[model samples]
Every structure is written in structure tokens, then in C-alpha cells.
Target: MIKTATRSTIFLFLLFGFLGFSQNKKNFSSIPNILQQIIPNDRIDSWVLVYNSYGKNQEIRTSGGKKDYTPQFSGFNLFPTEDSFYYIAYAAGGKMNYITDLEGLRKFVGKIDNAEEAAIVLTAEGYMVDEEFKDVAGNYYEDTANYYLDLGKLTSKECPYQKTHYALTVSKSSGDVSKVKDNGTYIELYNKKCANNPRLLKIQKKEEPKDDPKKSTRRK
Candidate 1:
């Protein structure tokens, strides 16, 4: 799939409420208060940080938080950058938080590689784990930000519906994705809220056309 949006501002966090991924922050005995805290046993290679920038001026970018998320993500603590405006730091060794400052982040990722770029694009587009990719593990990416995934504008999603490759636009959330596409695999904990979803049921139930009985007959 092609990654859309060269520049994205995730202001409206909406859609599927999946569980945000978490990681434990490694505490060091020599914890420096400054940006020198980029220590992963004092060694790291690849890492990723997904974040959205916000400010008072909708036009001007400023050093602020990533979307509405706090420094605390699951178990990992999100480290802010000097310039938390136009950057998504490369993944170090473990799943680190999104840092805006490029120079400050380099101390961790070492160098921004191609893999890091792709990862950034994917996370920005709100797909894979960046958005709400389940099954890779118990980690559910329940991003509340309004996102655009391919052609399908998913307003919301309750669980993971294993697809067989059919392109469909799910505008709203669902309790039972099976009602939408009966012939697909799915993994879910609960959908008690989606049992009476009239919209999902309407998508599959097509009205049958009645045949005209008053048409011309052979030789009656």
C-alpha cells in the first residue's frame, strides 16, 4: 500500500478505539535531567516514535505534545524534542516515544535510515501499528485521531476483521464485522455494543427485485 500525506497534522483523533502500545522506560542510575537521557544500555540502532504536533497558532508549528497523548505511553515514557514540530524520530532499539527535535533524537537512532522513513510514513498514514494493527501481538493501536486509510474512510472500528482482499469502505464502527462481510476471518474480545447496529446490517441486506408477471407470454 502507498503511504499518503507528505505532511500531516493529526488534530482530530477519532475512529476505532484500540489499545495504545506501551513500553517500559529504562531507568539509568546516571539519569541526566537534560537531553542526555538517550541511553539504551548506552547503545541503540532502530526505533520509532509516532506523534502529532499542535499549537496556539494552527499555522505556526511549535514545541508541544504529540496529539493529546501524555509523556506516558503504556509503560514507555515519551521524550520530547527541542523542536517538537516537524519531525518523527527514528526507532532506536526498543519502542521509544516520538521525539520532535532531530538533533536531540540522533543520539538514540544514530542515523535516520530508509526503514525509519517508511516507518514514519506508515505511522503518519494511520495504518499498520501506527493506526490500529492487531494480531501482530496483543498490542492494539487504538488511535483516536481522525485518519484516512486507503479508500476506506473508517469512522471507527471495534475489533480486527481478517480480510480476504476485498476493498470496502467501512464508514462507521461495528460490533460484528461478519455482518458486513460474512465471508471473512475476525478476532474480537467483545462487540456487545454493535449487536443492533442497523447500519452494518443494511450494508449486506440487498432488496430483491420482483419480476414483472404481466409481460408478453408465448402462445397462451
Candidate 2:
């Protein structure tokens, strides 16, 4: 019999795989006023922010009256707006970088030449949260209440919030973004709203799993 812990690990692995592990579903929450302040004209319904704790640290002053400080590192934030575009911003290494669209994000990542590809790549690495949802039965569901990402061994023992990583996901198109689990559905929606771009088609093709001849023969 499989151990309980092993079984749990297996279950989560399967669940993540089924949901396209990189797509982190999240619940809707009010975008921070600070973030909203940055983009006043655009209407944003969803967003994601992740701190890259691996970078160089800086001293942060405590809020209390006492003069105390702590170390903190900058990270990145991704958000989609009413317009068919997403924004990526990063503050690290004593420098700040912000990009308003996929093309700019491509330059920031300096990896894939394609903008859509770069957007997907950066989104996978960041924390993701989804918006609120209501089923046909009129039951409302939300994910922002108690959801957290387990950093596992990467979690710091000294930190108060152990094994917790903040993340979120925002849909760029219409319909219930929270229900989108696999890459196919995501790409389908992307195409509908963004006009079936060639790069996204390439990503869809790549995500298709090739049939295994050996496995098929064994089944027969």
C-alpha cells in the first residue's frame, strides 16, 4: 500500500498535471490601490504578483515608531486590463523595469523572441490567482481566502509564514477565467479574443502530447 504522504504527493502531482501545472488559478480580490494608482485609465479585473526572493536584499524600515529595519527583495507583477494586453513590472538589482505589452515583456525576459511566448513563460514563473466564480446553481466560489503555494524545502524556517508563497492568475479574455484549467482551453480563449495569433498556435501544438506506440501496443 502506498504511504499516506506518498499518496498525497501523487494526488497533487496528478492534479497539477491535469490543470497544466503552470496555470495557477486564483480568486478575485481588489487590486491594491498602489497598483491601481499606476494604471488609472485601464480597468483591471485580475492580477498576479510574485517576489523574487533570490535576489540581492535591501533594508526596509519598520512601520512602528521604533527605528527598526528588515531586509526585503523586489520582484515582479503581471496584470491584464480591459484592453487586450498585459503588463509586466519588475523591481530588482537596484533597478526598476516595466513593460506595458507582450513585445516589451519579450525584451525584458531576453529569451524568446516572440511576445506571446514570452508572456506565457513569465506567467508560469510568477504567482497566479483567479477571479471569483458563480456556478449555474448560483453558488459563488472564490480562491483568495486561504490559498497558498507550498515552497517546500525552499521555504524559510525563520520566516513567520512558512511554506507560503503568494501568487495569482488573471484571464486576458472573456468568460470565466477561473474555470480554465488546461492549455487547450486557455489557448482557445486567447485565440478568440486575440485573433488566433501564430505564436499561440505554436504553443498549442507544443502542448499536444504525442501518442506512445509502446503504450498503445501494450494496451492491445
Candidate 3:
């Protein structure tokens, strides 16, 4: 009698385990339909995975902030004949990235000089880029043109320390480039906090003229 009871208990446990596994598949059944209706001219692959960041591992949240582990998928497609785009929904991680291709994604990651959490998504409207960089602990400094290139080549008329993080083709009704500069203003101003001897901004500019002393006097 004891042996029979033990066998029955084990059977029940295995039966419940199999049921649970089968239910997980049901949860994913909507993935194909969702992809077909939403993603145009694309093949999709869906996955559910735990994400790790900031030394913590947690489930993802949807745009509505509901915590759930549904299959998130990526689709690759060609649009407008020559243009290519891909889309991936990351229901967790609280972020989305878009890029032109996998190669572009890889290059973007390599270019990040400061360590920060990031993800790439592929899109048709050029690569939508977003990133975070470690800010100087405090203060701002004026940087040379070389310094600007080393960090990220950005043109600014009023500020020297601002950094560029995103680019988009701006068009007015007449199809002319808009003349407003936005982004990196605070990054430029905040740099003054950490700069040593703010006067060095002048010195750095001075070094360039030394290469041609005659040119230096011409400016004066």
C-alpha cells in the first residue's frame, strides 16, 4: 500500500508539470497573428528573455507599464524598393532602438565611449539613435575642435562643451533645413564644472596659432 501511494503522488506531479509546460505554448500562440497584422513585408522571430542591467535582473514592462513576459519579436523587411527597415518590440527594458541594419547596430555600440545601457532597433526613417553617457561629476570646460572630434564632432556657435547624441533630417515647408540647434546645450554648459582653469579654453585655442606665428599676428 505504501509503494502504491508513492507512485500515485509522483504521477500527479508529472501530470501537472506537463500541463504547465503546454500552457506556456498557448501564451505564445498570438505571436504569429500579431506579427502578420502589424509588421508589413517582414519575417518575424519572437523571444522572451530576462533582461539584466544596473546590476539587476528583472522582467520587462510594456508601454503601459504592465509587467509581463509575452513574446517580443523582430521583423526584417524591405520597403519602398531600395529602403530597408527592421522592427523589434522590447516589452521590457523600458527602451527601444532602431537602426539601418545589424552592421549599423554593431558600429553604434562600438562608438559609445562611455558605458551605458543601450539597445538598437532597425527602422526606415534612418536609424533612430538614443544613448546615455556618464556625465562629468560636476562642472564644464571649453574644449578644442580636436577635443570636440574626439568626443563627437558637434558644431555649436554659442557653447563649446555640448555633445551631440541624435541626428534627424529636418525639413520646413519649403524643404529647407531648419536653422534651430537643439541638444547638448546642457552638456556644454555642465562641462564647465569639471574643467580645470576655465582659462584653458583660451590656451587650447592659442596652441593652434603657434604653428604659424605670422598667422597669429595677422589675427591681432
- The lDDT per prediction is 0.28, 0.33, 0.32
Residue 39's lDDT within candidate 1 is: 31
- Per-residue lDDT of 1-220 in model 1, one digit per residue for the tens? 1233322223222221221122321111210121222232234343334433333112122222323323422211122223333333333344444554433444433322222222222222232221232222112112222121221122234543222211112222321112122222332332535654555556546555555666535333
Clash totals in order: 14, 10, 17
lDDT of 2 by residue, 1-220 (tens): 4699899999999988757633543223332322232321123232232223235332221111222223224233344333222333344343444444434443444433222222233344442222221111011122332222211111222312122222223233321123222221111112333435567678789999999999999999
Model 3 Cα lDDT, one tens digit per residue, 133-184: 3131111111121001101223343435444433222221222223323344
TM-score of each: 0.21, 0.19, 0.23
Off by over 4 Å in 3: 1-42, 61-161, 165-167, 170-186, 189-220
The window of 10 residues in a row where model 3 has the poorest summed lDDT is 141-150
Which candidate achieves the best lDDT against the true structure?
A: 2
lDDT of 2: 0.33
Q: Higher-lDDT candidate among 2 and 3?
A: 2
